[model samples]
Target chain A: MTGQSTVLAADVPFPPSVEDFYLPSIVPWGGHDSYWFTKITALLWISVALIIIFFLVTYRKPKLVPTKKQWIAESIYGFVRNNIAVDMLGKRGINFAPYLTTLFVFILIMNFWAIVPFAQISPNSHIAFPAVLAVISYVMFIYIGMKHHGGLKYFKHALIPPAPWFILPLLIPIEFFSTFIVRPFSLAVRLFANMFAGHMLLLVFTLGGFAMLNANVWFAPFSVVSWAMTIALTFLEFLVICLQAYVFTVLTASYVQGALADEH
Target chain B: MGMTAVAYLIAGMLVWGGIGLLVDHWVGTKGIFAGIGAVVGIGGGVYLIVRRLGA
Candidate 1:
């Protein structure tokens, strides 16, 4: 038991760090110097390819009597359209349904990788991916507002609320901070933080199990418990993946709805 | 809707408290302005929420 525990201890690195998020470079064959490509990149590309191919193949020929594949594809689109877009934006929701559906699907797949075998890290755990998505949503809502309200009047409408003249100064800055600054920052940070935390939790539990097993014979029971917790947390991670994806899509739709609303 | 309300509350505090901190720096006050700023900011946040999110 002593000898086996020692070997196991050496195999498992206890207490994961930020460095674990940075996987070894795949291109140039595991070279440390270059991160030209990594598992994260592969997961992202695979997600994109899978989504595109799935939609294209499923919808290549429109059928009045939908097949299973078509039903699944249509269900995904219809769910976003009816549940998120239309619910949030009303009549104009159909116009934005495609983009919102794409966003929801992409985020769901990217986050799902955290619980997936082999590819155990989600690209969204990295802030860069979520930040980019947030920027797109930010720019979109502003653009829609400007177009709907006509020119700089959009800023006027968004910033100047239906309040009296005396309190305008205080309210304006608050509105600016909340609307302009907070919206995108929160959007990106929310998604990035959720995925990042989810991955870190799984790593801690999984590695902690091995660490315990390596520590001593008596700790073997605790090791099994830790592994069980890891399995349970994976199921929990699946829930977060779906939720964050839905929340991101819904918030984006809500922002667009905010932008498109007429003056009261 | 929940997130938006949170953002508004946080934004109000941040915007006002930040302004207060700057005022404290300029006036050489001992955190009084900062405290005042936060309260005022939060008050404005509640008002904004009522106007924007209230039915």
Candidate 2:
């Protein structure tokens, strides 16, 4: 929140800087050292709570004709169910609709938090959170393949593509890393980098604009331009946030599809 | 083979190449081991992609 970072007195040689924007405190309240209760942790829980509350309110009672709440809920569910899971996995994907929907919405909210006023940072900007999400997707992708095919068959299918035995030494490690390790690593990095970069961009403009305003009368116009850029970037960030969420959901579904397929 | 396969290839080379560099550091053999690891990684990655996706 720029509250602590805004203090910049000329008396002190070390004034507020941009790195201060990312509140990397181990503990929120001054207490024991802990990873718990960080801003990102709160954001993650808020996202989960919002999703649960959304569905809970929407489907509390059975209705022949749906209300606005039901309509919104159904639309979200339908989009993931039909557009993502169904499209990727066909009839077999029906069982995965709920999981995909949860994933899409969770990511959407986490990303959306960056642009939200007062809550300017996104939890996904941190690697740890994205890493966990990626691990979940990675495990599921591998697990589905393993379940569909036997364990031995699944690894064979994943590791050994239709290639000559002579190339095995070259192919095996690449396949192992790319197919198994890369999936989760890339997923986490992609999300973390986007969110991290977005937050930094916003911080620069917002803080630069403020710094300019406080510095001199001649710099006021440039301050206005900085603020304008910040506003414009907010809209672009909104689109990106939604898009990233959709991309994550779609890729997850496709991974499942790949896993379930008879062969690559 | 696919974007995913390509990603795998890059990841493979990066990871193995990194390990090779680490080993080189341990052995103090300059970039020799890293070069070997990188070449093997490229071949393996390409082979993996080709086998699964073909061509």
Candidate 3:
């Protein structure tokens, strides 16, 4: 098994690092100086364009009889609208259905890139994308809370739970830290870390094959097993991709619900 | 709800443990304040969880 391909496998960079995530510049055509455009940027724009074009094309004609494309579009929208938004937020969910649907679709597509043939890396593996998404959720919930509760009353509602006066100091700090600090941080890190770890796992298995094959001719069968494990992990990665997207959307909706709730 | 509970627990430890460290630095004690802060923080965490999530 470790035949002529051993020469080609010699360059397989074992133990992939964080540096592997920093892809080269696309605009400058592999130049290191300007990273204004890269695979991550391209994937992001592609996801945006694909979503826009898909929805526009599917909904171009309002058919009572529902074509295949329209059904798909409707199903995607309906899934997020009914299941996530409405289920979490009740009648008020309709107001947020559009934003939540868009968020769900965008994150789903971005995460799907991890298992894609040519595009093996997801843009979400980088913290920037998820961080921005988390910030939006954080700001949106706070804004909604403030609007609903009439000013600083939202802070009182969120931070000052239904508790007595004496132990208020202890509980208050925990609530503040959990709500104000932990929510956004965990939201961003959860998605980023999942994608990052998934990619790293695939890299390790894939490159480990080459490393094993190069170690000894007797290890060729082990290299094949390693490659097999990579294939298995790809399926697991798919499950994670859908799960993370759903989790992100659901959590956002839940946070919105928490904000909009009237005093427990 | 699960995430919220976890956040509460972690936040309790971090907030109190961080305060404990500050106290330790101030009082020139070793890890005593830090340990006490951690214990107090976790206790607060459990109380918060019961009050907020036990329903």
Candidate 4:
């Protein structure tokens, strides 16, 4: 009674707060201040844990006749083996199928987190994640190249391609720059920047709706339109998510193939 | 971005690239070109940073 207002308040305004909108981290670890970090990291780890658990459980008891889970696992394995490895790297590439498949599925799951509710962030949107992945692929390919060809031969193959001598100066430097520097950087940055910008755009529209809702009674109706756009964008993000993952895996296979081949 | 931030970013990228090159070499791949590329990236990064900061 003592704390009662002098006049009864009917329309209590919701104070503008920072909590409602999501702002992506521009640098790695920048999001630790917000829910974005916890949500995205937890979801990513959970995806990894689930993949491991699924494979372990499904393959723990192998059989000549497959169970439902076994069939699903085999299908996924075969899909990458046949489609990505064999198609890109040829028959010898079958051996790389498992690693490439793991990379694809893991990245796909991380990318999918962008569209998932509550989490609403892609881990790969952070440059560090993609950079780490690119490094792994870079290392793998280099290892494969050396393992296949001898020490000096790999360098000779990578730089000195089967081309005319006149173009050697231009091509060698260009090839060298592209294969070593541009390839991995572009691989990482492309995925990170795309996902990051996509998520940021989604955030802007979605939060704009909420911000508008607080403006006036007339503004309330426009929120639905904003939401509709958000939904459409969400669908587009899904396509991008899958496409980026595929591109990453495909590029990895191609790099490995290039490394293994006699010709550059 | 601030000059320091730009500098740090360039340095980080170069260091990472160098690390990548060294790893490739250690793994037994002929990574001489890769190492050169890393050095070039570092130089490019420094040049870009210098130009931006100078402006």
* lDDT of candidate 3 over A90-116, digit per residue (tens): 999999999999999999999999999
Tell me the lDDT of model 4 at A149. 92
Order of quality (TM-score): 1, 3, 2, 4
lDDT of 1 by residue, A60-144 (tens): 9979999999999999999999999999899899999999999999999999999999999999999999999999999999999
Residue-level lDDT for A30 in candidate 3? 96
Report the C-alpha lDDT of model 4 over A1-264, residue by residue, as the tens digit. 112221221232233233423445534556565544555567778999989999999999989999999999898888889999999788887899999999988998899989999778888877888999999999899888988898768877776655567645534553465567776887798889988888877877776666556656787678789778999999999999999998889888988987897741
Give the top-scoring candidate (DockQ).
1
Which is superior by lDDT, 1 or 2? Answer: 1
TM-scores for every predicted model: 0.98, 0.83, 0.97, 0.70
Whole-model lDDT per candidate = 0.94, 0.80, 0.93, 0.73
Q: How many clashing pairs does model 1 include?
A: 0
**Which docking band does candidate 2 fall into?**
medium
By summed lDDT, the worst window of 10 consecutive residues in model 4 chain A runs over: A1-10
Candidate 2: where is the Cα deviation over 4 Å? A1-35, B15-47
The candidate scoring highest on TM-score is 1
Off by over 4 Å in 4: A1-37, A216-218, B1-55
| Candidate scoring better on TM-score of 1 and 2 | 1
Model 4 earns a TM-score of 0.70
